[model samples]
Target chain A: MSCGSSPFGALADDTRRAVLSLLSEHGELTVTQIAEQFTHIGRTAVSMQLRVLRDAGLVKERRAGKYRYYSLRVEPVHEVISFLNSLYGASLDGLARAAEASADQEPAAASDAPDPTGTDKDTPRWGISY
Target chain B: MGNLVLSQQRHLALPPADVFALLGSDRTAGWLFGADYQALRVGALVQFELPLNPDDPNGSTVDAFGRIASLTPPHRLVIDQQSPWVGRLICTLTPVSGGRGTVVRLGVEVPEDAVTWLLRQRGYDPLEEPTPPATVRIGVLTSKSGPASVFAAATENLARMAAAEVNADGGVAGTGHKVHVVLRDDASKPEVGAVQFRRMVAVEGCRAVVTNVTSEVFDAVAPLARRLGALLIYTPVNEGGRFRPGVMRLGERPRGQLRLALPTLVREAGGKRCYLVGNDYVWPRTTNRVARAEIERIGGVVVGEQYRALGTTRFDDLIEDIAAAGADLIVSTFVGSDEARFERQSYAAGLRDTTRTLSLAFDESTREFTGDDAARGVWTTFNYFQELGSDGNTAFLRRYRATFGATAPPLSSITESVYEAIHMLAASGALNTDANLTELVSAVRAQRFSPTWPSAQPEQRRTGEKALYLAESIPGGFRISAN
Candidate 1:
C-alpha cells in the first residue's frame, strides 16, 4: 500500500503485530484459534483487533460452516515496500547529483582544497551523525 | 412539502440478472415470507401479510396492498401501497464492476399531509398548522387508549407539565423559544407508533421526541428515528438492553431493578420458593431471564414460570396453577391493565393471604385500578415514588397539584420519568430547534442535572441511576419503606 494507505497504523499495537506474525507463520486461523495462542488477552479483544485489521484491509476473512477463517493479504505489504523503495531511491539520486557537482568543481578548487577525494574531515561520508 | 422517506441499500454476491429474477419471479415468495403478488408489470397489484409488531410473536397481521407504479426489467420496480398507511416503494438493481455481484436499493416514501389528514379524521391530530418560528416542537408518543394505556396514564399530563414549567422559566436555555408539545397515541400498537413517529418528524418538524410505550413500539420506532435522523428519548421500564445512535433510554433496567428487588424479597419477605409470570413478549422473556438468575443467586428456588399474551384478562387458570405450586412469592412482570387483572384475580383466589407478591410493573396508577383490597400487602421496587420525602420531590408535587388541580391522574414512576426526560432535554441543551443528532446525543450523555425526583444517577448511556425504593401497598397508595 502507499504510505497513506499502509496498515502500519493498525499494526502499531504489539498484540495486533503479533496477530499478523502468527497469521503469516500459519496459513489461516479462526478467531478462536488465534485467541488460544494468547494468554494475557481474551477472545473478544482478539476479535476486535482482527476487526480493525479487516477494516484496514490487512486481512481477509472467509466463512466455512459456522467458523470464520482469517488470512493476511500480502498486496498491502508489497505496496508499502514499493513506497519505501521509491522514497529511498529519490534520496540516493539527490546524493549522486550532489557528488557529481562536487566532482565537476574539484579541479577548479584543487589548490584551495586539500582533500581531493571529495571527503571533508569534519563531515562523515555516510551523511550520518555519531 | 413534507414527505416521510425510508431508504435501505444492500450488496448481494449474485449477478444483477439473478437478483432481479428473485425480485420479479414468483420465487420471491419463498424468501419474502410467502408473499403473494401478481406478475411484475405496470398496473399489477400485489398483496402480502406483514406482522403488526415484529417484537410480538402473537401479534396480529395486516394485509399490505400495492400496485406496480412503474416497471423496468431487472433494473427498477416502483410500487405504491394504499392501505392502512399510504406510501410508495421503489427498488433498484445495478451490476457491480466484477459482474458477479449487484447493489440493490429499496426506498419508501409517505406524504405527510395525507397522513396528517388521516390522523385528524381518526380524532388524533399530533401535528399543528403552521408551527411558529419561535417554538420548539417536541413529540410525545404514548399509549393513551389501549391495553397498555394504564401504564402511560400520566405520561401526557406530566410531559405537558414539564413543558409548561420550562416555558415558564424563560423557555429553553440559549434559545428563547417556547416549547410546543405534540401528543400521539400509539394505541399499544407498534405499527401505529412507527407511522406517528414519521409524521412527527416529517410534518411537525419535531426537534426531539419522548416515547413512553412498550418495548415493541420502541423497537419499531427506533430504527425509523435513526433513519430519519430524529432524536428519540425513550422512557420506560422494560428489558432495557437497547443502545443505538440518536436513541437514549432513561428508564430502569430489569437487571438493576431485579438485582435489588429479588434479594430483598427473599431475605425480608421469606420468599424461599418463587414463581414468575408476565406477558408473552420479548421484554418479559428477557427480563425473566435476569430475574431467574437473580432468584437463583439469592438461594431461592424457582417453582414455576408462565407467560400470557398481552390483553389477556382472565387469569383464573394461572392463579390456580400458582396456588397448586404452593409458591411463597410471585414475581409478576405484566404491564398495564393485565397487571391489574392478575393482581385482582389473585386476591380473589385467596393467594394473597398465603403468598407475597412482588411486581416490577406495579406503579401508583396501576395500583389505583387494582383496588385497595387487591393491592394491599403487594410490594414493588422502583426508582421514583410520589411519596418520596425530598425537597425536590415535595416542591415538584406541590407545583404539579397546583397546576392540574385535584382530579388529575396520579403521579407514578412512568409519568415522572417523562417529566424528568423533558427537563433532561432542556438541561442537555437539546431544546434547540436547530440541534443535530450528534449534538443532542452527546449533550444527553454528558448531562448530569438533578431533577426534583431522583431515579437513576445521570450516566453516559442514558440509563437512570438512582436509589431504588421498596414499598408496600396501603389503602389508596403505597407506604414506601426506609431504604
Candidate 2:
C-alpha cells in the first residue's frame, strides 16, 4: 500500500498521523507504546490502526512472542523528508553562510571532496574540503 | 608647510580657460578618479604596491593586493595587479561637455575573483610599467550610519589620517600640495548614498569619489561620477559584478574570499550534508546558491537551507528543527548585530556544540557588539587585525585611540581601502598641488598609501601591499590563528 491509495489511505486523520509520529520518534513501538497517548481510543482501536499503518507502507510490524511492535519504513520516511524539504525550501541558506566565510564561493572542481584535514584546503579557488 | 604649491613639472602652460576648468574643477564636488583620471596626463608609470591589511596567514581571506603598472596619457592606464576578482578593467576616460561643463565618461571591469585567483595562484602573472602623470581623484562613498555603517565608517577616519600624512609629505610627485578628504554619510541606504553622492559632487565640488559598498549602493552612484567628470575609486567589495569602465575597483571580490572559508568546514564534521542559515538578503541567498552548487559538485549534499528576514531575533524553533534533521554542520551567514543573538540562541537550544558557525562581515566591530562570549570560537575573516601581533597595527590602534579616545574596532580591507584612497589622492594632489575636485582626482590617481608606511601624519605611509588576516574568537578576545 502507498500514501493516498487506501480507502482510509486518502484519509489524513489527526489520530492516524499522531500514531506515525510516535513510531518514527521511538523507532519501533508495541501496541501499548503507541496507545499510551491515544487515550481517546482504546488498545483495540490502536491495534487496528497499526494494521492500517502497516498496510499503507507508513509502518511495519514485528511480533516478539506476546507483543507486536510497529516501526516506520525508510521509504515513507524519505517521502516525508522530501515533502518537508519542499515545504521549507529556504532553509540552510542561512547556515551555508557559516561555510561561506571560508571557501564559500568555491564549489567542488572535481567529483571528489578535498582532504578533510588538508592545510591547503583553501589553496585552490575551486577546491572543496568537506 | 600648509600653503605650499607646485611649480610646473613638464613645461606645460595651460590656456586661461582650460586652466580655469582644471583649477575650478574643485567646484565639481565628489568627483571620482577613474582609469582616465581627469588630472593624470599621458605617460605616468605609478610604481606602487597594492596595500593590504596583512592578516591572512592561516589561509584566511586575501584581498586587494597588487602592483601599479602604468598610467598612460589621455584617458588610458594599465595596472599589473593579478586579481581575478577584477575583470582587467580597461578603463577609458573621455571628457565631454555636460550642462556647459565637461563630463568624464568611463568604462570599467567586472570579473569573478576565483578565476583571477586561479590564474595567479597557479603561476599566472602580468608584467609592465610606465611613467606618465596618470592623474586620478580618489573618492570615498562609505556608509557612515545605519545597518552597514560599522564596516566602512572607520574608513573615513583612517582616510583622513592617511590623506593628511600623504599630503604633508612631498606628495605623489614629491611636490607641495596636501590631500583633502570630502566625507559624507551614506546612511547605509542605497537611496541615501545616491543622494549623498550627488551632493558630494554638486554641492561639495569634490573632484573624485571613493567608496566601499554593496552593489545596490554602488549602482546608485556609478553613473553620476561619469556625468560629473570625477574619478570613481572602488575599494573593498562585498559582491562582485559592478565594474563600470570609469570605475577602478580595488579589493578582493566575493568568490576569492568565500573560497577561503568553505571546503575546510565541510570536512571538519565528517558529514556530507549541511544546513545553511543567513540573513534573507542578496548576499546570503547568493552565497547559499553558490554553496549548494559547490556541495553538489563535490558529491556532498545540501540537506537544507533556511533564511530569516533582516531583523529576526528568535531561533528556538529553528534550532529544534535543525537538531531533528541530524545535520553534521549548520552553516551561518548572519552578520553584525544579528550574529550575537543567533549564537546565544543556537547554544541555548543545545545546537551550539553540535554545529560550528562561520561568518563573513563579522569583524572586530561585530565582536565588540556581540561580546567575546557569544562569538567565542566562532570564526570570521578580514585583511586587518585589531588583535594581531603587528607593530603597524599597534601604531594604527594608538593613533585611533588618541583620536577617538578609544580603540577603533578592527579595520578590514574595505576600511583600509578607505584609508588608502585618501592617502593615494593626497599623493596625486601633491603633484598638481590643489584642494578642489580636479586636482584631488589627479592627486589620487598618482599617489599610493600603505597600511604601515610613514608620512607627515606619523600614522600613515606608502607601504605597497595589503595582506589578509584570519582570526577566531578565543578567551581574551579574537586571536590571530596563524600569527
Candidate 3:
C-alpha cells in the first residue's frame, strides 16, 4: 500500500475479499491453503494479494516452522465502517432538509384543491426530490 | 496481429521438478478446476473447465479446449488453446542457486480481455502493467438500490464487459489506451447521483460518464457534466425531446416504443378504451402524456390515468379502479419493482381476461421478476432484447452469457443499452483526450457501434436511430413478435 491508499482499496478485489473472509472464518491460513480456495487464480496471485493485505494492515503474518500463516487484522476497516456510517447519516440529514423545504413551499390545504382551469394537468404538489 | 503476451514470475519454496509437478497432471487441476490430461505430453490434447464462480466449486463451469505444444518436465510446458479466446500458455521452471526453491516464469499469449479478467479474478489490479497503458476513466452511475434497482442488476456487468472488449481490441480506436470503468450507485435518487457524478469527475478524474439511473438523475447531472467539462451519456428508455450540450441520450425513446407497439397491441386486444398508468416522474409523466395523445389519434378513449409514487408495490386499489372503468387497453409506464408488482397484481385480479397491457419498461429481467404466469401476453417494445433471433443478437447473447454464467441475471434493453453506450464512447476516441463537450458529441455522432462482439457481419447502428423490436412475454422468456 502507498500513501493515501485506504484499506478499502485493498478490499476492492474479489479474491482479496474472499481471502479475508476465509481468514476471518478459519482464524489463520497459509499461502498454499488460501491458494487452494481459488481455482481460477494461481498460488503466485494469492501470495501477491496476501502481500497487499499485509501492506494495508488488513492482515498480519505469523511465521512458524518455515511456513507463514496469515490472520485478519480488522483495525483498518473500522475507519472505513465509520466513514460509511457518516455518509448514510449525512444523506438522511439531506433528505430531511429537502422534505422540510418542499413542505414549506406547498401548504397542506393546497394539496387536495382541484385544478381551477378544469384541465387534466395536476396541481403543484410537493415532490419527493428524486 | 498476434495475441499480447502476459508474463509472471514467482519464486516458490519447492524444487524444479516439484514446482513442475504442481502445475502438471492432477495437481494442475487443483487450480485449473478440471484437466483431462494427467501426464502431460507434447502431442496430447488438454482440456480445462474454469469455474464461473471460484468460491462455488460445484457450480457451473466453462470449458477451455487446448492442445499441448511442448512439454519438458521440470523445465518447460506450453499449450495452445482453441475455444473461447485463442491463446498459447507457457510455463517455465528454473532451479535456484542452492536448490532451495524454484523460480517459475509463466506467460500467456492472450488478449488483454482474458489477461485483465484473469488478474481481476485473482484480486490483482487488472490495469497494472509493466508499462501501464494510458487510461481513460469513465464513470458509470446506476441505481444499485431504490425503486429502479431491479432493472439495473446487469448494467454494471454489461458495461464492464463492453469496456473489457474495447480494451482487448486494442483500446479505443487503436490508441493503445485502456478504458477504466468507475462504477457508482445513485440509490435511485437524483441528489445522490449528482454527488456521485461530481465525485467521479472531480475526485476520480473521469472524462466521461455513462448513466443507467432514472431520468431524474439525468436532469440533475446533465448541467453538472457541462460545467465540469465531462461527457454524459444516459442509457435507458426516456422521454426524448432535446439534447443538452455535453450530454447524449442513447435509449429507446417513449415515442418510438409506443408508436410501434400500441397500434398492434390495441388492434389485437380489440379495444379502444385505454387506461394510462405510470410512476410519478418526468419519464412516466411524459410517457403518459404522449400515450394519451397517441390513444386519441387512434380513435381510442382515455378511460383513466394515474401516477403512483416510485416503489409502490400495492396495486390492489389501482386494479379495482381500472376494472371499474372497464379499461380494455392498459398502458403501463411503471418501472422496475413497481412494474413487476403491477403486472403481478393485475394478473392476479384476473384483469388480463378482459384487458391487455402494453408495458413501456418491461424487459427480460422484468418479465422474469414478474413471473412467467403473471407476465405472459404482456407486450413491450425496445431496440434490443435477449430473445432476438438475429445472428448478431445470438452472438451478443453468447458472449454475454459466456462472461457472466448461464445463471446470471437475464439481459434487458436497459442493460444492453449501457453496453452500446460504452462501446460508442470508446469508438468516438474522444475518451482518449480532454476534448470539450461539443467536440466529443460530434465525434460520437460520426461513429456507429456494433451491438454484438466478435461479429463477422455486424449490425451497426447510430445512437440517433436504432431498429426497434416488439416482444411479448412467453413461458421461460420473451417472444419477439414479427413486425
Candidate 4:
C-alpha cells in the first residue's frame, strides 16, 4: 500500500480505511475520540495514520481552540468513483457497439446472441427476442 | 566608523514642544557634546569637543563637528558630520496621541569604509580591514523537510538577514564583496546532507558552510567538510563528541546544560527520582549518560530509562512505564516532532499532573508544535530565549519583526546561533582576509566578539561561557523562571 502520492493509497490500509469509515459514519471526531474507538493501536499510531490520511486529502481537519476535528472528505472518494466508472463504461460501450454492428451485418449470426432456448433460433430472432 | 549607522528612539512623557525646547537649548547641546554650539539653524556649523574620558584629566579629546542640514521646528532635524567619521545624523519629534507625550527618534548613518577609522579613534580593533572584496559566498545546510523540518523553520531567513546586514554595511570588511548565502536543504537525511555539503564546496565554491541539522546528519557531513578542507560551523545543541580541527561546535554541551539544570531540578522542583527517555542516537544517548551521572551525583535515582528509534510516534507504553516508575521528573532528549509527540502523549496519559519534564532539546519552535496545555509546566534550559529583556535583544527582536512580520517562526537558539556564527565569522576576518581554513579557524578562535544577544561571557574558544536560562512552558511559549 502506498501512502505518498495517491489518495487511494492512504485508504488501502485496514486501519486508515477503518478511520475513514468511522469518520464517514460519525461526521467528525477529534484525535482523542477517534483513538478511543481503537484499543489495540496506540494514539500516536492513530495520529500518524490520520496524518497520512490528511496528507492524501482523504480527511479534512478543523481546529477549535486546542482540539483538531477530522472529518471524511467525500470529494476524493467521488473523484475515484467517477474515474473507475469512466474506465469500465468506455469498454462496455465498445462491446455494445460491436454487438450491434455484428447483428446488422450478419442477420443469421444467432450464436452472437447466444440463444438460451433452441426454440428462439427457429423464429426471426430480433423480433422474437424483442 | 565611516559606515556605522546608529538609530535610537525614545518615547518621552513630555509634549513635543517641551522635548524640542530641550533638544535645541545650549544646555542639552553641552550634554550631547562638551561645548556650546551656535544656535540650531540650517546652514550653521555646530562644533563640540568630545572628551575620551570625562573623569580623567589626562585623557585626550576629539573635535566633533557637524553642519545643520535641515531644521523643521518640533518635527525633524538633520545634521551632516564629517570630522571623526563621515556620516549623517537625523532627529525627529512627533506628538503622541491625546496630547500627552512625544516620540523622539535619532538616526546616524555612516559609510562602511570609515568604520575601521572610527574604531581606531575609539582605541578598539576593527573587526575587519577598511577595504573588502567585490563579492563573497557562504553556504547554509538545513532541513527543509522530514522529521527535523519542524526545528529547521526560519534557518534560511536568519542566515539571509545576517548576510543582508553585512552587505548593507558595505560587504565583507576588507574584501568589499557582497556576501551571498547559498542555501540547500538536507531533507534530514545523512546521505543527502553529505551530497549537499559536497555540492556547496565543490560546485558553489563556498569556503565555509553552516549547518543547522540533526547530529546524525552533522556527523555524516563533518567528514566531507574535513576532506574538502572547508570550515564547518555546527549550530545545533548535540551530544558532546570528538570533531575535526576546522569544525566549530556552537551548541551547548549536554554536560554543561544538565550540570546547571539538574541540581536546580532536584532542589526546586523536588525531583528526586527521574525517568529518562529519548531518541536512540548519539545526541540523546550521550546526553542521557550525562543526565544519569548528574542525577546520581545529586543523590537522585534513575528510576527508569527507555529509547525509541528516530521518528517513533508511539509513546503510550513509554508513558505508562514512566507513570509506573513513580519518578518525579522526566528527562527527555528527544528532538523535533518526536519530542512533541512524546509530550502530548504523556500529558494525555496524565503523567504531567504528577511529573515535571526537563527536555534537553525543547525550544520555542518545538513548543509551537506541542499544544500549549500539552507542554505546560515543562522545563528546558537554553542560552537564549525569545522573551529575554536586554537592549541589544530588544533591538534585534524589533528589527526581526519588522523584517519578517509577526507570523515569522519563533526565534530559537539554533537559528539565533546561526545568526551569531555568521557575524562572528565576518568579524574574524574570514571573509575580509585571504586566510585559509586553518588560519581562519585560528583567527576566529582568537577573537572574543560580543554576540548580538548577551551570552554568559565573551566567547573565547569555539565554546563560550553561556549563561543558560531555565524556562517553564507557558501558554504561548516558555517563560524564564527564577533560577
C-alpha lDDT of all candidate models, in order: 0.67, 0.49, 0.68, 0.65
Q: What is the DockQ of each candidate?
A: 0.01, 0.01, 0.02, 0.01
Best of the candidates, TM-score:
3
Candidate RMSDs in order: 27.6, 31.9, 22.8, 29.3
Model 3, span B311-392: residue lDDT tens: 6869999999999999999999998868987998999999999999999999876786677789987999987878766787
Please, what is the TM-score per model? 0.58, 0.49, 0.59, 0.57
Candidate 4 stretches greater than 4 Å from native = A1-130, B1-133, B432-435, B448-464
How far off is model 3, as Cα RMSD? 22.8
Candidate 4 residue lDDT tens string, A1-130: 1123321111144467567657766889999999998988989999999997787566889999999999976455334333322322222222223323333444444233332121111110000010
- Superposed Cα deviation of residue B343, candidate 2 (Å): 3.3
- lDDT of candidate 2 at residue B457, scale 0 to 100: 21
**How much is B482 displaced in model 1, in angstroms?**
4.3
TM-score of 1: 0.58
Tens digits of per-residue lDDT, candidate 2, B1-483, equal 011111101101111133223221332211112111212432221111111111211221111211233444444444322221222223233332221111121222223322222221211211111113433224467653334544643665677677666655654445444445655545445665775576556544456678876555776777887787666777764555554545566655445544565565555556767787887766677766776776676677777788876546577777787888877766676754466667767766666566656666666655644545666756666665566555666676677657643323445555766665565554453324234445544445445443223422222223444445456766545766531
- Clash tally, candidates in order: 8, 97, 0, 18
- DockQ of candidate 4 relative to the true structure: 0.01
